[model samples]
Target: MANTNLKHSSPQGGRLRSAVAITAILSLYSASAMADGGMASMCFFITYMKQIVGSVAVIAIFVWVMGYFEKKAVLADIGQYVVLGCMIAAMAGWFVSQAGLVPPSCSA
Candidate 1:
């Protein structure tokens, strides 16, 4: 008799899943932020783009800082960091946009 069991799964697969989940969540959040006039009003394309780009940059910086301090090279850790970073950045962007920081030219 032979036993069939799965010994292991790829680490990257886990990271990929985490990243996808975070991306979807953040995307929905962004949409809601716009729908409710929570961030940049989202009525204009340029403003939306700027908000997304800026938020992404902020998130990446935060994630990089975490990577630097933890010295953890694990994919799961990085994935978690990425999720946190994006959430924080999205919140920040939403605030900035709501505060009327976005230019009028950006309004549609």
Candidate 2:
């Protein structure tokens, strides 16, 4: 039989599928936001980034908790780094808002 194992063993297919799915979802979201209005587009972009950062923070907290329980020094160190990154992201977002890079979407 021909070497079919090599073709089946590659992870490229899975990666490609994931890439395509993410691209499609992002494109759809962008298109919908654009259809809404310029303000909506800007707000959507900001909201999306905030959500992504928030998600990373949550994941980091989870890792930190797991590391604490397991007593793995390396994992705990990585968790600290992730937490720092989350803090930086939050600061950057705040800075952008303060700088008026984008108009405020919601009223105080």
Candidate 3:
């Protein structure tokens, strides 16, 4: 009899599962933050945006370095560029919110 147990054999799979879990948790937190409007919510939103921007920057740099080494696929490069664009848009939105351009209900 042969027994095949492959669930824990792939590190990449484990990492992917962990990433999904973290994303789900953060999304729930974000929803709650939106629901709770106040100075604390504003601060949480800003902090979350900053964390996203930082993560994007890190991923972009990693992809750039990998591309330089000719180890990354073109699709990865494109994805990184897309993420960079989103990061830029997010930063702009944050600035606008800070400038009181956003609705008081959300920004306050």
Candidate 4:
């Protein structure tokens, strides 16, 4: 019985352990990467705005469609996507303005 229980639980336990290990590794990677100024990630984020927005929009549409078919839960994902998109766009715009890619309308 103990052996059977161990056999039965090993795969699931291994998966959980691996997941936790991966999470820790990724967290460390991101923390170290961001310990500086995050110049690379910021550049990537700016360059990939369209891809990010499209990916999020696709997810939102998928959720909306699922909600349509399911009809049990409201499709709140689209709103979330819109909010995220707007926030990213605003931040990107700010970064661009700071980088002097776009000139400020007003002088300080």
Instruction: Tell me the tens digit of each residue's lDDT in model 4 across 1-25.
Output: 3455665577887799899997897
* Residue 31, model 1, lDDT: 77
Per-residue lDDT tens digits of candidate 3, residues 3-58? 35786467887799899998998889878987876656667866787677777777
For model 4, name the residue pairs that clash. Answer: none
Q: List candidate 4 segments past 4 Å from native.
A: 1-43, 76-108
Per model, state how many residue pairs clash.
0, 0, 0, 0
Predicted candidate 1 versus true structure: per-residue lDDT over 37-92, tens digit per residue: 64354444445555676676666667666676788656446656666766776677
CA lDDT, candidate 1, residue 86? 64
TM-score of 1: 0.34
Q: Candidate 1's C-alpha lDDT? A: 0.66
lDDT of 2 by residue, 1-108 (tens): 754676675688678979999999988998999999988887887788788888998998889888899998877888899999989989987887778786767321
- Compared with the true structure, all predictions reach lDDT values of 0.66, 0.83, 0.73, 0.63
Model 1, poorest ten-residue lDDT window? 38-47
Instruction: Give the candidate number with the greatest lDDT.
Output: 2
Superposed Cα deviation of residue 10, candidate 3 (Å): 24
Summed over model 2, clashes come to 0
Model 1 stretches astray by more than 4 angstroms:
1-6, 38-108
